[model samples]
Target: MTHHNDGVTTMPPTAAAAQAHRRTLLKAGLFGAASMAAGLRAPAVRAQAKRFAGVTINGAAFQHSFHAALKSWLPELEDKTGLKVNFELQSFPIYNQRMDLELSTHGSAYDFCNIGTPYAGRWITSGWMTQLDEFAHNANLTAADWEPGDFARGPLAILSDANGHIFGFPWVAGAIVMGIARSDLLEKAKLPIPATLDELVQTCLRTNAPGKTYAFVNDQLHHWEWPPYLMNEGGTIFRQPPTDLMPMLNTPQAIKAAEIYTQLLSSKCAPPGVLSYTDDQSQRMQLAGRANIRTASIDWLVPLAKLKDSKVRSTVRYAPLPKGPGGSFPGVNANGFGIPVGAKNKEAAWTFIQWALSKASFERMALQKAYVTVPRRSIIATPQFKEAMTINGQDVGQLYIDTVDAPGVSDYMKYRNMAVFPQVGEKINIAISQIISGQANAKTALDQAESAAIADIRKAGVKL
Candidate 1:
């Protein structure tokens, strides 16, 4: 399978090879058998040797900083808990599917797992997760210190239940609505960098040179990308106050937004293959100088910088999502850590979560991976962290700092079936594609997508 620039590749691993990898990991643990055994059984291990032993958790294949932090922290945890902690990292899709299957069986395959905000509701309702309220209270971990409004009640709240029972701790926190552009290309166009959606679209149209360069591109199929545009137009997918499901796709504001997006393709402002462009494709286009603008997580900056001979290196720029009617609306994405309901070592797991999320640990992790942003408000404000952000070549650290301190947008998830948003998103993409290809009229495509979206929501058993 071809790998997209999204830093993810799908390589079909032979069953035998996979099993061998697992066996290899298991054998590696055996080298420290005495330590591992004592670590597994809490009381038998010595205090110094108890950091982390016999504890196993699973997380998706996150970026370097997170994985590197886990490598550093796991040993410390083993020493503290006298339990051996192991992490099984897999791709996001694989992890999501495996987690769902394991939860269905209430399997003990993992004591802890990293879950996204979207799946939090279903996981908690199904009794697959353990409540972390008591743990928080006991640890004297005040919500005030963590920017709960920005980090919790907003986006991260999707990982909590309706009654205020939190099932997870915020692991990775950052905005998902920043624009990345090739500075070299923008200079060549002699245009000021766009700080608003309108300016961005206009820039794309002005700079587009069909056979040479396209203006902007992205993975149009993902539902998450739509909200920034919606918010920019003073519209929302679902209105608050009972959170009624609004078919924003058919709204005039959405139609307008769709027109702008479709125009990029229809007017030749983007590459001909843009409809099939994934996130990685967007990244690659920007890196290769084939496109001028894209949206990406801050985690991508490091990898982009690492591309030594790339023309865009050191010349790439990032800023918050451009303003629209709502004026610079940005969306946030987060990874959450949760303990399984069936976990045999709840206390140990909680201890690790608490320790890992502490200010000191967060700082250490952020520095090791050169992470530009850390979820903890306190960590970001520190001088050391500011320096680290500078070293990472991020000019928007203050933006992230202010955003995390007072985040405007929140994380969102659809009803349990998950198919609701994606299905609707797909129809919308199809309509946009057709319009771009001149196969269908814009209004007709929007109308068809709106109808399909409402039907899908009903089929998913959502009340709205």
Candidate 2:
């Protein structure tokens, strides 16, 4: 018998191994007929119960929250669906590289994967993912609570193509473009919440104290961090459809956004060496009270409310990114559950996906603060969810949701990490680095990047 990604192969299982597997399932309350008697919705369970009993569903997900949720909820999935799930989790960078390799070469290894929206375009174009339109509407398979409409539109739109081929179901619908601040610092400084981009910059400058605390920090290397500011200023990295994308990185709005973004470091408002900070490093500064404002994912900061060793644990507050000159458009990012085209146990994989993303399961994770930006409306409306988003006794879940669902809020994935986008972004990242390092001004750096980006895109000759 060959050992596959899911650990189950075509060869027959030995009696002892089979018996052990059954005992494990039985312990999880997945025994045939007995599960129905336990008051677990029999109708829903009966139709698919043990239908893929001996099947092993392999899964791959990112290491942080997604993997955490999987580890905490896999037992429930096994008990409910009677499908053995074997999951592999890797750190962010490693997972991105590995998943790309697996999808491009060894798609059969994992039945399904938790795919970030940014990579959706790459996977879809490769013809590596199965279209799930029929599986979702199949009444016999989908649970009653799995309403497609329940997903926030921002997330749903990103997961689908122009023709509305939904390649995946949203699992993490978060606005990584929101702002979080230290409430205590703001109060002590006698400053009010910033309502616009200029005000945010001013707030950062005013609150900053050299060698003691800085006012702002963001993950600048990822490239997408520029969107919240750029889009809000009515600028974009590119214009027109992806296939015919025209680089607009050096436009008036873009230059202004870039000037302001890099100014934080140049003006000494952000900590020194901010150019080297990743998402974790940026947030660590805030957690340690070395910075007063952070423009990043709210999902990353919500768990800090419970961190015992953190200085700002009880003082942190969630806020929408300040409105820009044109308007306020926070950038929303998402991750979804996708089935590989070569998955042998796709049916079993779908079953596990349904169970894992169900309302009950989501609520369980929400109580544990596993996710702050929930995908489902039912989970968002729950009291437990409200509690999870509470800061200083204020339930701010609605604020976070509104930010994520805001109009014109750029869905980073909707741009679809096309082959060209990454190329364009790489140039822009270099340009940003040059500006931040004081080696070039915004216009000069971006002008060079823009020309190079256009050339690269044209060279790719990607057709829509």
Candidate 3:
């Protein structure tokens, strides 16, 4: 409404002038009312679009595909939320060692970090990571569609405490599955994909050559690779993980698995430097057609068929890690982002995490980067995504889901969830190296490992 002023002069004031002043007062009153109404409808932070304008989130994590995909959208995150991010990516080992020191000292150098499954238990129990329940459930901070329930339960359980306090939002959840780089070798040998332990050994022997193309390859992290074999042989790491907490490394089952895994490496089925091959090296070996089979997460194996640089792209095939009489237990793990308890900018870091692990972001990373190990059921269940992950007539997406749904994954993974597992796991690796080098047989090596693990666990203050 507009007010018109009459051009008439009077002794005191004209009616038009009085009316104009009343109109101005009415407008002011209405404006205040509208402002209040808007405030009631929207969060204050939303009202101020640049609320965190000067905030900077210093994040630190290991170099991973999910982080690599996320960095591509850093500028977009800043523009959307007025938060600047200085994210540092390091190798897995370097990040773990440095983060351990930072957490132990309560340093606040990083606002957010990659909380891997193996370290999450120790970090969470130590109170190094911020409890994310407050931030995740905050209506004003978290969006309605953020859907904390969308995360796969198995992987999400890894990041949650007994009281159901979630510490991280997952980005990479992977299950160990077999990738055959030489279908031609299987075809020539006239054998189907190996489905049992005995068959795996036989298949490996049939396809293995003394030199040139190797029959099998595994990463240097034998603690991770060997556990499934142990479980398959009815062996276990603990008497009962998270309960008894006893070291069972010297059990008969463990010795059998150790013998089998060491045989794979020591019998010349794997490369000369199989004991030293990192995860990247193992993947490259299969991609270059130098390794006949590789058992790892879809994150690494899928690249053999999808990455343009792969020499085995046309010959690669996918299968679950071969099952055995004791039952198959493929390794499953997730890496997620969480705010450090010492972080000065916890809220801003949480904002970045929610955005990075948002459903939309998962889709974009999967579709755009061809990343296959996302732990969201909604995306993984979609027909388009299923189609996107299919390779060479193999439903690798379904294989991933099956691997996650495997019963042993949840029951057996509790062993790895113990805070002292890393130390004990290192002992397992050392013992395996001893067996491979002929310093000890399987039983002797594992007996030494159990002794060392008991000492380490007790030193870590675990009752057993």
Candidate 4:
């Protein structure tokens, strides 16, 4: 096997080389507990069994709990399938770019890949990925075994192209646009934590002060946070679904949301260099007492609590997104694994995916030191997981549970020019930056963004 990255490719482990590596891993004690926890009984040594050649999978390489769990199970997979699998981790920002480039060139670089739900539609439609419905059915992986609500019809529908063919399995599924705050800070401030957008704005104004902690800071990049704010206000960047050709980016509600965000920035309610901050920066700022409130993924809370800094450890809390005029509108995003089209070893790739997603493995992974929320319904309801959350002082695990169960707004490729939402997000980011920098008013900035996005979407050949 060979692994390639950044124009460099290197030979991966051979069958004999991998067998030796597996023995070393066993000696170092990486697989014993996971195997036992999953009730995976070791087989008697076979006399020179057929060796399935190795495969490489590409996915986001961040230090997320899901990746850690997958790492824990890799050794066991090697033992069972006789397939040496290599994982190439990329940052989320570059993950899609790399995957698209590989697919476009028809490079046999990855047998499987982890794709976000938003991009899955494009991949399926473009024929970059295989239809997994039959494969999943053959493997006896029923939707019933997984969290029905997490992969409910509404959300799962977004994971398909116009033809309604499923392209990926729900891996680490959850709504990402929500708030995590220092509950202890709100208690100290003698203020009730806001549950509505109006209240949230007031709280920010009241709690913000230079040289003192500000109340709220959000990631200003082209990502999940601002989209929910628009959704909550009953507004959307585009008038139709999936394609970006006919954008309503300058809707009144959108301008209102942008104005509020601009006020927060101008009032210094956010940290210095806030515009340069991404999701991690916002989370770190809140965890370090630089800000009291932040909008981020619910999955982030568990890791944030485990931070070495005592301030964040003792103070953090999680909550659903504040209600907007449209009610408690929140944006949903999903990440999961998919088989790439033309994979050389499709069966072996599916075997690894099935093993990683089995109920047994899900339970073991969720209970790891870092509390990763698995998408399996059975795993979330387990008493052990509940107790773990309680012990870690994170009682809001149920909030995540309930949030995932609820209906949410999903991004599909069909609405604006196919797969243009990310580009729309960039326009929104630029507009917000202009508003905050005082180079343009909220209405003016959003108007320009709306016009530019519409033009771009039209040029992409998507009909409104």
Candidate 5:
């Protein structure tokens, strides 16, 4: 065996190598309680060992709970599934660019990869995704412990097409967009927990004490960051499903949402330099007690709940995002595993997916708090996970559930589901940048965005 510096190890395709792999795994402490559970059923898997033996599957590195599992659990995983995986971690943008080229050329560079749910539709439509119906239906390929029905319906739906061709296994179920507030600040300001965006802003403004404290903070660095506000107010970057797709961002509803968003930033209720903050910085300020409220992805709450040095550890509270006049809407996004159409080792890939997402695996990972949102209901309902998901003794699962089930929540990939996402998303980002920089009003910026989006769609040969 030759160990490669790029996180890969090359081994001869022989029984001896397989035995050595098992030995390496045991030394790495892969046989924990979880592996014991997996071990009991290892014999059943051996019945199909020939299918995956000597085959190497490749996957991109994703910043997900699955990543934690991939790093520490693969030996046990390979032990049971008889497949070797080369895990490559990279930024999503760079990974996606490389994947696009590979997928476009039908290259078999990776047998398995992680893909955002928003791009599920585009990949399936482009014939780059392997429809998973057959693999899922195979008993040898699926474990009874991995119940398909246990997965949350919303996430499963988005990862599949209208005809029910699933593109991949749901790997990451992020919490719906929600707000985390400093409970102490809300009490100090004598403000009720806000239920609308306007109320949220007002609460922030009232609670804000200038240099002593800040009121609100959000990540505005990405174009998708503000769509929760837009959707809550009956605005959309594109028309909703079952309707013809077109840009509706320049409308009155969107302009109003943009105005409110900018006002919250410019009013100094939030800290300075918020326009450049990403998810980490935005959440850090609130956890550090620099801000009273932070609106963001639900997943952030998990780390906040566990942070040892967090100033607001006991004071953080989770709730659905504040509503707009139209209603409360949040953003929902998903990350998961997909098999490429060109994959040479799809059987091994399928085997890997099954083992990785099995009920036993999910339960073990959840116990470690590896992922805040496990897509499966059974896993989240487990006593271990229920206890782990609490904040300051409050079971915040209901907040996550309600936000996920909320009607009209923006699917984080709105325009990205179409093939023109790269171009259109960039334009949308530019438009919001103009608004944040005071170079253009909402109407003018969104108008330009709308035109750019249309042109991109036309260039892609996609008819609305």
Candidate 6:
């Protein structure tokens, strides 16, 4: 026998015929063992593909910072599940329009869709979403570390039905805290951040400079922006939402809240066309330092410090929505993904959602993209997250955690959980507009709103 560069013994064919014949059986045994290991490794790789390779998860939601951030991480999801994802992120108005239509018709256009906080009640109770308890509890589908308890109770309640079964998981948190866009302006005037409702008004009036910079800026979404002010002034949309289905829009407390809102806007404390401002417009004015104060969700406030284009990065200060006679309240809302009741791919859709809302996913979003809007308390409690979310040495993540926990004491935001709130909130939008424009007095406008809201609630079959 001769050993060559081939690393195997080679022999003259005639001389080593006997030896080669003898080794054939031994070689076959070795080959079988090697093939078995490779076969095991190959199936593991193939198993990933076999799970969901040809499937494409169709989902959609209003364009949000979290959705935008998730786009960059799609490869991780697609790779792990061996599936393609075709999630369409539309503008807020467009998404809402399409979603309402889909819900009404029971269309299966999306495997999963965003459950807007205001619409959660209507969607869940109407049987438009799939119950997630099965997928969440199944050991084969969901890994144990998902920890449903990590979500804030307020947000989870928003997504659960009357029976307390979960249908959606929160991914977008709307923790409405106050942002001082021009702290330099507040400090130059020797004013501290307002601690009470009265101080907020006086501070805005003192800081008013309409020609150069507006003192206050609130977007056209009165349903979202105006409620905090109304609630702070001891007003409520319903007597007690989800329990007492009565409309309380015309109460003394509500009129008082309206008057406060009207005065703040009509005194030239706001921009000339403030009511026409969209969220993007209002946020732009704040980030450009043309607005002194903005009360909005953390999603918008964080941009004041983190965005490269922010003119007020160094000057912005964060605070809870100021206290009033009723109480100190900060608005919290959420948007999360859920499978449509009409969807065909419920299991695969959850596979995406489970990984999407996983602890690992949240950690990457917060640490890499500074997405503080995640409602998972566990992620927010991390030192790494706190460090990443800190801007100019401020623990902004702490403010989010506090705002989330604020309503846990009494569930003040329960009003938003009623299915008819969106309909009722539209009436409020018109009332506030009329009051601000002098088309009607606060009480008259509010009374008209109360009548309209009652009609809406009744139409939705809510008993009064």
How much is 84 displaced in model 5, in angstroms? 1.6
lDDT of 5: 0.72
Q: Model 2: how far is 424 from its true place, Å?
A: 1.8
CA lDDT of each candidate? 0.64, 0.74, 0.84, 0.65, 0.72, 0.82
Write model 2 residue lDDT over 321-440, tens digit each, in one string: 787877776767778888988888888888877877777767776776556778887788887777767777766788777865665443434565454667877887898889988789
TM-score attained by model 5: 0.84
* lDDT agreement of model 3 with the native: 0.84
Candidate 1 stretches greater than 4 Å from native: 1-65, 124-127, 140-155, 162-164, 241-243, 265-267, 301-310, 391-394, 411-439
Q: Which candidate gets the maximum lDDT versus the true structure?
A: 3
Model 4 has how many clashing residue pairs?
A: 10
Worst 10 residues of 3 by lDDT: 3-12
**lDDT tens string, model 6, 353-423?**
98788888888888777777878989888989888778777888888888876555226777777778888
Which parts of model 3 are misplaced by more than 4 Å? Answer: 1-48, 162-164, 405-408
* Poorest stretch of ten by lDDT in candidate 4: 41-50
The number of residue pairs in model 5 that clash at the backbone is: 3
Better of 2 and 3 by lDDT: 3
Residue-wise C-alpha lDDT for candidate 3, range 354-430, written one tens digit per residue? 99999999999988888788888889998988997788888889999878655445566777667888888898999
User: Candidate 2, which ten residues in sequence have the lowest lDDT sum?
Assistant: 408-417
Give the local distance difference test score of model 6.
0.82
Pairs in steric clash, model 6: none
What does each candidate score in C-alpha RMSD? 14.8, 11.4, 7.6, 13.0, 11.7, 4.8
- Which residue pairs in candidate 3 collide? none
Query: How should the candidates be ordered by TM-score, best one leading?
Result: 6, 3, 2, 5, 4, 1
